[model samples]
Target: MNKMVKGRIYTLIGAIGWGLSGACGQYLMNDSAVSPIYLTALRMIIAGVFLTILAFFKQPEQFKTLISTPKEMFQILYFGIFGLMLCQLTYLIAIHDSNAGTATVLQYTCPILIVIYVSLKEKTAPTVMEFAAIFFALVGTFVIATHGNPFNLSLTPAGLFWGIISAFTYALYTLLPGKLIYRWGSLIVTGLGLLSGGILFYIGSASWQYTIQWKPYTFIAFIGIIGIGTIFAYTLYLEGVSLIGPVQGSLLASAEPISSVFFSIILLGEVFQGIDIVGIVLILIAVYLITMKEQLQEKHMRIKH
Candidate 1:
């Protein structure tokens, strides 16, 4: 297959993997006695270890360079803690409080947050398309939370709060590590960042005190969360980005919530009403519009050059 085809396939696989992880997370939280904090810590630690080992073998030079610079080390540590750790914790919390589909769709609002942030930072008004995206995102969020009723919220307050927080942290996670990824490559930066963040979570949560029940289903969920969800999804998505560029990769990753919704219905028996489906469609359309605009701009620039 050509690079483009491979990139698309990788991106789709990565998205599906993430969607499956969220579904598995919801199942584990509902079925098992595992605390979200403990599950988050364990998943991070195992995925971090796996990614670190992979990085060591695949890019030893980058791994060596990653630890050599004190400044970058601090940045990585910060990224790991604030970016990766917080993102995962809040996301899992959302899943625990709400269904996987709701959490996943709400988290997709990150692009709108990114638009607002960039516009503020650049001291410029958002363009028309951006305004449209923001509007759709807001309306979509309201619909999802309220289930078509303006006054009645379908999602719990805790779920809504954590879901929005997860979106913000996810934006930070994407933005904060640009320099490190450029300098050390995505694999190295991501591996070390995961390790650092996982360590921080473990320390803060005192996860060792939690007595884990080792049932077969629990073990399977752990594998899904750590192995397929974190390590494989991250790795494949980064590889896809390397091949197809961020705009296209992100566009492809819109598949995640769709897969999340599908899996949630089948696995968790989460009922999606008409309003909820409309909310999902609007959010996805907003994302598609924004990403498509970026892709078009890139094409225009290439044509101009």
Candidate 2:
């Protein structure tokens, strides 16, 4: 297969896994007696354990090397605590304060934030198209959040605050991994970061109201989705960022909302209105334009060089 085709396939698989995992999480929140905080903590711990074991058995040398460096240790801690723990915890809390769809969209604002972050780090202003994309995204988000009536918004102040916090923290998380991945290999960075995050998650989970019911399907789904779905989804998405480039990767990752909407319809039986459909399209277009802006800049650099 061509690179484009491979990228699409990988992206689609990652998006599906990630999109479905969100649904799975929402289900647990609704069906089980688990607190969102506890559930997020347990999920991270379990997934982190599996990842740590995989690294230990499969690539002990690399894992050892990753741990040996102080810088690497900091990276792991940063990702585990700030990136993973903060993002998940804040996002779940945001969802509790608001709707899941709204929370998801808010968290996705990370990609746009990333574009700005990358540009600022490079000490360059974004191009016109990039601004246009940002504009569309902002407008689309407003429409979705306010239900097409931006003037008369109904979002709770607490929910809005938490949701934006989730967005900012997650954007930081996404940016931090790239730096770590550059120093260590993706697998090692991912494994160590996850393990660290998992530790934090365990501590958080411990403080919450916890109950364990041995439902076979629930346990299986948790393992299957949280273990494989979440882990592999992130790993592959990061790999895509490495292989294709973050601009393209972010565009692909932006498809998360589409997949989320899809699963929400199929799994949650959520009704979609015409306005929702339009919002989805606008968001997609905005994401595409924003992420592609990097490519445009690179092309210009190449011409000048």
Candidate 3:
């Protein structure tokens, strides 16, 4: 098989693994009575260890460089707590408050948030495509929150609130570590970032105070979250993105939400109204629009230079 095709396959499977993670998290929250905050802490710690191990073996030099750099400690620390930790916590909270399908789709709105953020930082207005993405994201979120009626409230307040927070934090997750990832590489940086967040969450949140049943299914779900969903997903997606580049990778990464919806419906027996599906499609449209706009901007820059 061609390398690019293999990369695509890896990325697709990795994305599907993330979808399974959300379903497994929902299952545990419903069946095993796990606390969302504790689960997030455990996930960050375990997945952080696993990814760090992979990074040590796969990119020893990068891992070494990351640990040796004392100046960037603050940035990495911030990325962990505010970016990864909060993002994960809010996402799980959203899932617990609503469902995997809704949480995942809402979280997909991060691209629009990123666009808006860039516009603000640059002191410029959004271009036509960016404006369209914002419109789609807003309308889509409104559809989900209100079922297309201004007065009718369909999703819970907590669900919508956490989902929106997750989007913003996820955008922060993407934006915060740009320089770190570029310098030290994503595997090591993200591995270290996860470790930082996990340490803070474990101590600050007192995650040890929470108790959970250790059944076979509990281990299964945990392995799904820590092993497949996070470590493998990050590793494969990074490798695939390295091969195919960010433009195609971003487009392919959209599979994460689609797979989440699929697993939610098929495994978790979650149902979505027609309007919910419409909202999901609209959000996806915004994603594609933003992706194309990014590609165009990059192309223009290259030509100008």
Clashes of each: 0, 1, 0
Best by TM-score: 1
Which residue ranges in model 3 land beyond 4 Å of their true spot?
Answer: 214-216, 302-305
Question: What local distance difference test score does each model get?
Answer: 0.89, 0.71, 0.88
| Candidate 2 lowest-lDDT run of ten | 212-221
lDDT of 3 by residue, 218-273 (tens): 88888887788888888888888888778878888899899999999998899989
Output the lDDT of residue 285, model 2: 81
Better of 1 and 3 by TM-score: 1
At residue 76, what lDDT does model 2 achieve? 87
TM-score-sorted candidate list, best first: 1, 3, 2
lDDT for 91 (candidate 1):
91
Clashing pairs in 1: none
Give Cα distance to truth, residue 9, candidate 1, Å.
Answer: 0.1
What TM-score would you give candidate 3 relative to the actual structure? Answer: 0.96
Candidate 3 all-Cα RMSD: 1.4
RMSD (CA, Å), each prediction: 1.3, 3.0, 1.4
